[model samples]
Target: MSEGNKNTNTEPWGGFDDNLIQRGGSAVIDMENMDDTSGSSFEDVGEMHQRMKDEEEVTAEAAATEEEGGEDGEFLGMKGIKGQLGRQVADEVWRAGKRQASKAFNLYANIDILRPYFDVEPIQVRNRLIESLIPVRMINFPQKVAGELYGPMMLVFTLVAILLHGMKTSGTVIREGTLMGTAIGTCFGYWLGVSSFIYFLAYLCNAQITMLQMLSLLGYGLFSHCVVLFVTYSVHFHSLFYLLWLVFGGLSTLRMVAVLISRTVGQTPRLILCGTLAALHMLFLLYLHFAYHKIVEGILDTLEGPNVPPIQRVARDLPNAITVLNATGKALAAGADAILTQ
Candidate 1:
């Protein structure tokens, strides 16, 4: 056997490798490197195993060090610092936790005490107020234009509405002056149609709306019409005026849609409404045309009189003038097209 193997098989205490050791010197240690006062010894294998176990315990201690130990349980606190610094951090964490718990307990106690007297309905109202203030969606560029125009347009409408109210309340009509009423109604309708068309155009471009926005337009028109009718005796207080304006504007938009959706499979609800309104308006206008023919003829006779004001006569003749203009324009367009084709 070699010297190294001989050392492995024998002990300094006169035992073979298989012999059980006495507690005194069974632990074989490297005395030069070891603490000499403790009477400790180590066998080569035993020393290695003990060193491994010590190392494992130190690793475990380091892992556990992150959590601060308390009587109740382990708390997630500064376990990173060493010695006194770690203890200080642990103390601060414990204090903060206690403070937070006490505050929470107090809050709960107060809520419980007030629960019986609390009115939930008011809470709902407050919530609704907050929700209303929180903007649902932003208004785009076109909607901004609509908002800017809405104010002045509304003022005009309010004046008209006031005039209408006055006429309805007065319940008086001049003789052979019924045509004047028809003319006024028609003009009001035309103005309303222009305003509505512009408003709707803006809304369409923006592709957004709110109930408030709709109401703003309606209110303005109502107020404007009221002012116009109440301040002047101009037999123009016709509700149909505003109705036709809304109807015609809607029809114009519908016509535009029809052009775009010619090949599409379905009609929108707006298209249906527009079609219905246009049909009804046309029928109603036809009925009025026949009904007021005699009154209109009488008004035309007055227009022939030299004493009649040019403005009054112009107002009387305007409807027929518009019809002529429309026909003339269409004919001119057709003529131009024919000349081009040739």
Candidate 2:
């Protein structure tokens, strides 16, 4: 019996000699330590080590998949891990949105223009754009955007106004290419006058002013001209339209003088000197009117239509208007007579 017990002690726990199994000289089994093949355990340690190694490999693969943000996280019940990763993705999306908003802001520069060109608010911009064409005290007004932006924009609008007026006067799509040339010439001529005035201000008054500010003011002054042009287009059929437009042009000229007086304040004989430059504005308007009318007449003559003198053309159309009025009156009178007979 003693010899049998000694043999049993030399072997593993095979239903006998239970001295706590003596795994690595430890009395207790650490199941957590089963992953380490260096340690020993009960129930076929070699086989358990092989199984643990396989389980560790599978755990490592699942961990790698989670780190890589693959589709395997849901299968492995690693939804909590994805929550941490979602923040990085959201940050990227937010940055992209900011880029798009910035681009959109640049494309629509006039969205905050607060008022239309012909608006009559109780108080205009503090720069006193309403009181004068361009207030010298623009340095006081706080703008959401740059002052430089408003100047070039005004010029662009002036160009558009010229194009519209030319199209209306020509009244033919066939002459669009020629009309475009005329429009460009008209704008160029107006700017040439403005440039000449700017040079005069420099020579006569020695006004310490920037050309950019003068350009900005001149462009703003052109807005009144644009409005007056629109009125002309609206009422051109009326004989007195030209006379009425000239009245508005005179008022626009005064506002331009105000713009110049504000700029050339320190110079002696300021009003007279400014007037010399300001007179150019009136001449510019007159030149535009005469040149525009002549161009329109020339275009009408060149066009493939009834070749007649402008006087003849109007004399011809005027009779038709009178004839239509007479016909309509006769038709109404006949209808009334028929009703009376009934």
Off by over 4 Å in 1: 1-153, 156-208, 216-266, 276-297, 302-342
On residues 147-237, what C-alpha lDDT tens digit does candidate 1 reach at each position? 2223434444444444334333333234455634644664356445534553464355442434334333332233323322333333333
lDDT by residue (tens digit), candidate 2, 7-118: 4333222212111122222322233222333443455765445434443444454356556765433422343223223323443555577689888986687565633433
Alpha-carbon lDDT, every model: 0.38, 0.48
TM-score of candidate 2 to 2 decimals: 0.40
**TM-score per candidate:** 0.21, 0.40
Q: Which segments of model 2 are wrong by more than 4 Å?
A: 1-129, 133-152, 171-177, 196-200, 237-247, 265-272, 294-342
Clashes of each: 31, 0
Clash pairs, candidate 2, are none
